[model samples]
Target: MLKLKYYLSLIVWNLFVNTLGKSMFTPQSIRFLLYKMAGMRTASANIRSGCSFRGKNLVIEQGVFLNHNVFIDSWEKVLIQENTAIAFDVLICTSSHKIGGPFKRVGDSDRKPIVIGQGCWIGARATILPGVTIGDGCIIAAGSVVNKDCKAHTLYAGVPAKEIRPLENREVNANIK
Candidate 1:
């Protein structure tokens, strides 16, 4: 089937990238070039080592940056809008089990589209689940598991993350010590 082939190709490509491309890049430019060849939009972006993109329809828009150990289980279309930043160890997954099925299966689950809006920041080790739409300018805290839609200009934290507060300053000091 078409889906089967797609999955197979993804596996093969991931293996090749992990095995060969992992050790060959010293600078971010080299990694960006490799990502371009592998069907990622990497202009002004840094998708770090150990990152995984499993779906053919994974769309990383302009200025999107994914840091180290990022894992995207995008069986369907996972769209990271322009200027979004996914920090280290972040996992955005777009697949989930069909609980109504007679027997449980891994890939037999229904797939959903994950949309991370522009200028959003997903912190380290955060997990964005299937069917979640993160609004523009939203900030997901580190180690959080987001299972619902997050509003724009809001800061969300905790497991099954709830809204913590609104982003008052629009300026996250990246250089804060």
Candidate 2:
């Protein structure tokens, strides 16, 4: 019975995603619609229109919102943890070219998982390169290019995303209050 269920699920998923290319609407619109309708979550989360997600290995947790025009390429597993917000036009990629030879074939490429830890905010236009992890509560500034792992509770900016400063709780509260 379980095997039958699994096979049925696989067939449904393939038909819905592959044969259809999920083409009932635009990719972003479809993602928003599906996430709102049937995507499970511990708390309500809003995914704005115009966010594009490809590949099937993606996971979005509770209270994780994907803002407008954000592009998430999930060829490998891309996990966005609870309370994380990916801002408008933020691009998260999980695939990279093979560097071994001059001409790189698609089959020779490398793919790795991208993990966005809980409570992290990836700002608008931030480009997170393949295989990078943004730790919990970290802030990725707008227009930055991140190709390295970011520490928890810190602010990272600039090309390649060097840590700028540790996040201060009192400072955050002051702004909120």
Candidate 3:
């Protein structure tokens, strides 16, 4: 069955590709090949070892580099556009539990997609919450917790991630290699 195959592939990826410490030394093409074989849509991506995700709702565009220990909990969908670089230990989640009395009692949770536009740079250890849309050429500061949508060509930082300043005349340099 389809579901059985999906689970088996997930197990293989986690065991063979994600857990091995030496998998980082493996060529990027092999890593991408394994991910694509597991049903993820990836193009020219360099996802380092120890990166973990569930399901097949991840779309990583061309020239995107995901550094080590990146965790994408894509219960919904996650779209990382071209030339984006997500740094180490970044957590991009697409699901969270609902708060309040009745919802908590019923174990209700919400799911929404996360979209990171082209030429964006997500700094180290940034936590992107559910339903966040980071615009093109934006720079997320290190250790920032982004709970809301971000604007293009700007820098965001801090706990809740406030816009620090607009990146004037620097959108051309925001493309990550």
Candidate 4:
């Protein structure tokens, strides 16, 4: 029965989500429903088309807005809290192998969960690596590659995502979603 359920989910995703539902013309509500059938655990999110999650371990809370072409590797848990604005072309990955033998280069890091706190704004084209916990009200700059935990109410930028500054006026990001 469990196996059957998995197969059914695949059918739903492949037929609905992986089809015209991927079109930018397709409404987010319909796409969200289809993704639910495929086992994603989003309660109330506005997810645009072209967002890809290979695994079903994604948890998107209310008021979360995922922009276009967002790619998530949800092999582990990905908890995106309420009012988080994930901008276009963001890549949230949860998988990376630990450093292994010389023959395999895939084993260089550990696969871990990614947690994005509430009222956060992930800028366009940012690549969030595995095990990153972005704190509440944080803003990641565009084209930044986040490889570590981001402090609350902070602004992060650059290749490895250094903390640029503390966001003293938290009200600024409240309207991001």
Predicted structure with the largest lDDT when compared to the true one: 4
TM-score-best of 2 and 4: 4
Predicted candidate 2 versus true structure: per-residue lDDT over 1-177, tens digit per residue: 999997886666545443333333546445444444433222433666555566767888878887777787889988899999889999999988775545544446689999999999899999999889899999999999999999999999998789999996444556664
Best by TM-score: 4
Candidate 1 per-residue lDDT over residues 66-155, each given as its tens digit: 887788887888889899998988988998876554554444577888999999999999999999999999999999999999999899
Per-candidate clash tally? 0, 0, 0, 2
Judge candidate 2 against the unseen true structure and give its global Cα lDDT, from 0 to 1. 0.76
TM-score of each predicted structure versus truth: 0.80, 0.73, 0.84, 0.86
How would the candidate models be sorted by TM-score, starting from the highest? 4, 3, 1, 2
As for model 3, its CA RMSD to the true structure in angstroms is 3.5
Against the correct fold, how does model 1 do in TM-score? 0.80
Question: Each candidate's root-mean-square deviation in Å?
Answer: 4.0, 5.1, 3.5, 3.2
Supply the TM-score for candidate 3.
0.84
- Of the candidates numbered 1 and 2, which has the greater lDDT value? 1
Go through the candidates in order and give each one's C-alpha lDDT.
0.80, 0.76, 0.85, 0.87
Alpha-carbon error at 40 in model 1, in Å?
A: 2.8
* Alpha-carbon RMSD, candidate 1: 4.0
Candidate 2 Cα deviation (angstroms), residue 42: 9.8
